[model samples]
Target: MTETFTYTDDLQIEVVNEGTAKFEDQKPQALIDLKSWISDEIKAGNIEGWLPYNNFESSVTWKIIPK
Candidate 1:
């Protein structure tokens, strides 16, 4: 399944599952998972100029595309 994560306020991450059209709040642990995922993607050079700390206040959307 593909998921889209939208970072909102503190401890409020909105998750949208594309396959099921389901929406829910990400668990606290998901924050760590997200950070790790972003870090990996950055290392792979998938994204540029945006870090987790720098984009917290603004709206950031990350799509987890299925392989």
Candidate 2:
């Protein structure tokens, strides 16, 4: 899915979803929104945290400060 989402040069963030998604007709917007969301998370100081005893959920949170 790398073709669907373009990464910045610095490479300090990652996005993960639990299941399949439909990006048809909104691929660009999805990427833009994803980046913006990540940027906002970093600006708000949201760091990756762990959730013990829950192996079915994702643990990493976005804290990527945009340049």
Candidate 3:
């Protein structure tokens, strides 16, 4: 399952695979699409910050914090 959590005043997006949910492993296209969506949001002034991938595996998060 794809789960998204919004925190930090709704300016951040935290996505992950929990339990039996491993979307990245099963579908590479999903990851690509996800990044594209994130980029669009950032360009549209939705999310507020940017960072490098946070984990060992392909990243499943888009967290941006204003400076």
The TM-scores of all predictions, comma-separated, are 0.34, 0.46, 0.43
> How do the residues 1-67 of candidate 3 rate in per-residue lDDT, one tens digit apiece?
4444433464545555433445456578865666677768778876533333425434444556432
Error of 2 at 56 (Å): 15
Candidate 2: what lDDT?
0.43
Evaluated at residue 45, the lDDT of candidate 2 is 68
Q: Which residue ranges in model 1 land beyond 4 Å of their true spot?
A: 1-24, 48-67
> Which residue segments of model 3 deviate by more than 4 Å?
1-14, 17-20, 48-62, 65-67
Candidate 1, residue 36: lDDT:
68
Report the error of model 3 at residue 14, Å. Answer: 4.2
Candidate closer to the true structure by TM-score (higher is better), 1 or 3: 3
For each candidate, the alpha-carbon lDDT, in order, equals 0.43, 0.43, 0.53
Candidate 3 TM-score to native: 0.43
Q: Which pairs of residues have clashing backbones in candidate 3?
A: 49-64, 49-65
Candidate 1, residues 1-67, lDDT tens digits: the string is 3344443332222233232222235556655766566658656866423333323533234533332
Which residue pairs show backbone clashes in model 1? Answer: none
